[model samples]
Target: MNADHADDSLLICRTLGGCPDATRARATGLDADGMDFAVAVAGIEVPVRIPFARRISERAEIRQEVVRMYEQACDALGVPPRSAERNSRSRPGLK
Candidate 1:
């Protein structure tokens, strides 16, 4: 696998915590490989809100606009947005 594929596999494994070779397995329809690819394309939406002094007010509006745009694009592509789990089990201080 190429670097990008490896990265996606790593992310899939990290997030889903399934069989290590599941991502490498062949995709026979909507299986692990297909789901990995889809998730790589349309990842879980984690809303980010950064506070900057100059554009504080504008940032909120821009953030909403961008989120709306992303939702519209996902709708057009027929892929649903994956919501983040309330409890993340990943190591703290890690991205």
Candidate 2:
């Protein structure tokens, strides 16, 4: 299911804001049935595709699935997940 432009703003903002290296206010223009946004990860601009969905429930489900898929892809690529990195840095007694 493809989501229209109006439906995905919150997810976009949240996703962008969560990363320290993200472009902050930059998002690529829409193409086809999806839109691309870039976030700086490990000093690299990583493009994330946001798909369209017709309803909020579908969007919610899509968000969960997308997160799961992204984690899997990171594992396959031998890249660390963002949360792991963030948490590692935040704990006081661990260097």
Candidate 3:
């Protein structure tokens, strides 16, 4: 990831709890409008593009958008948001 996309990438990873799937996922590209993820589905690395509803010009908007996306994904999967306690517990050496 480049400097321009580092923050957004971090936000996306954290909100999604690393990745939605375990198949060698990565934030391959990002722009002011959207992001591209390289994920392996069925042993094939596919490029998935997620576009923003509106152009995001500032870094502050990243968190909100990531959270919204994460929540939507969780709802779609019929799972609850990963709680702070669970997150902390799951991470090694975290208190």
lDDT of each: 0.32, 0.44, 0.54
Cα-based TM-score, every candidate: 0.28, 0.33, 0.60
Cα deviation at 39, candidate 3, in Å, is 0.8
List, in order, the clash count of every candidate structure: 0, 4, 0
- lDDT (tens digit, per residue) of candidate 1 on 1-95: 23423332333333333332322321112221122222221344222222222332443454443344334433443445333323653422113
Report the lDDT tens digits of candidate 3 across residue range 1-95.
43544333433443343444434446776678877776555577777677765788898886666667655554554555455336542421111
Inter-residue clash pairs, candidate 1: none
On the 0 to 100 scale, the lDDT of residue 27 in model 3 is: 74
- Which candidate leads in TM-score? 3
RMSD of candidate 1 to the true fold? Answer: 15.7
Over 22-87, each residue of candidate 2 has an lDDT whose tens digit, in order, gives 433235654434446654456666666665432234445655544554455445445566576775
Ranking by lDDT: 3, 2, 1
Clashing pairs in 3: none
* Winning candidate number (lDDT): 3
Cα error, residue 84 of model 2, in Å, equals: 0.8
